[model samples]
Target: MAGRKKTFHGVSVGILMVKTGFRRLPGDVGHAGTWDFPVQYRVVEGATPDKMMALESSGLLDEFKAAALDLVAGGVDGIATTCGFLALYQRELTAACGVPVASSSLLQVPLAHRLIAPDKRVGILTFSRESLHASHLEAVGVAADTPVEGMPADSVFVTAIKSGDTVPRFEAMRAEVLQAAERLLGSHPDVGAIVSECANMTPFSADIAERFGIPVFDGVSLINWFQAGLRPRRYPQA
Candidate 1:
């Protein structure tokens, strides 16, 4: 690409991360070990989880756009963010970055909806149900009536994240995530697939699918797909 000032090569995915000190587990987007391929990360300082949940009114769009453009300048072929709530800035970030941008895991909702039976729905497990408004879903073409469930404000998952707990109890966090998934599935029996809206929830995605016996989509899936397109594998001549 044009205007690339990269000092490195081969890493095509650039992750725009929200500033946090919490320990990122293997499946979390902020964790480097989560991907089979290489990736570069840029942290937007001061862009915390609470601000992301209120992104529409948070006035951080320009900051996010600037960070995305910086990544593009540094030579990443595509851009993605750590928080699914960044769905509100999808269009803006894509335009500013001048490269393919997967701003949120919620981008998979429309596809998840298509993957399931017509009578079934795509359920969303988010960081905050009260904050995931129709505009956020609509920004990414998800229907306004899509089913959603959020982790309880007082749950271990939320508290640890908000406090940036460096030594979070994985088992407790996993249980909290499972409970949220259960609420989403139980209240909406027609939910045939789940879209996890919190990038941090990816560690428990397998548990969700195995427990519910349904497909689970998250930031990892979206970024993996994004990376594939940016740097497709080549094979030896047959």
Candidate 2:
């Protein structure tokens, strides 16, 4: 009923996958010396349109791919790029990784669609205007018409992006993002679940849900599931 399987020890298995995303983030964009604290969100600080389009430091994308590959070589099952803005590079990275890379966390789009009825839509909270486009929608398996929203420049999050610092009032940032979500859901006539477009937004997931009374998803949790699905195992001794 299916293709032949690859077996390690006695167990047949699926391919390992890794996510590859843009790496424009600089050392200063981080907080507490760890990209671990909503690491991807700090991306906005460095990955501006000017920086992204610059030909000189264009190697940022390549750097991320290299990092992803190294991570995979070590034992990561699959890869998923943290930045949704990399939709244009999705196809390229998926091929380069030679594994079941999800390309972007937007893989949850179809899942979110299934989780709700046919007419509902999902709101995506992204870093900047670069995230909204037909190509990005297509890459995530969502319709071009799917309701989407961006983290507006006026918000504290956008301020964080530009200043590379957390706002004195994170509550304001959360409110702005949720405000965008509210507009999308209320106007679209079809928003079901909410998906965070940035890694930093993960910290706001539960907050968004509690405020909006709707499902909110971020790349980290979904990445874990994607990794879990393709995780490698140690074969038993014969």
Candidate 2 achieves a global lDDT of: 0.57
lDDT of 1: 0.91
Candidate 1's C-alpha runs over 4 A off are 2-5
TM-score of each: 0.97, 0.69
Who wins the lDDT comparison?
Answer: 1
Over 59-116, each residue of candidate 1 has an lDDT whose tens digit, in order, gives 9988888888888887889999899988999888887878899999999998988888
Predicted candidate 1, C-alpha RMSD = 1.2
Please write out the lDDT profile of model 2 over residues 1-238, one tens digit for every residue.
Answer: 1232322222111221222232222222222232322212112224454454231344556755675565445444455554555555666667777666665557787788788877677767676644367776677677776667777766766665555453354566667867777777777756778877665566567777898788887765565566456544458998
Q: How many backbone clashes does candidate 2 have?
A: 11
Model 1 TM-score on a 0 to 1 scale? 0.97
Worst 10 contiguous positions by lDDT, candidate 2: 11-20
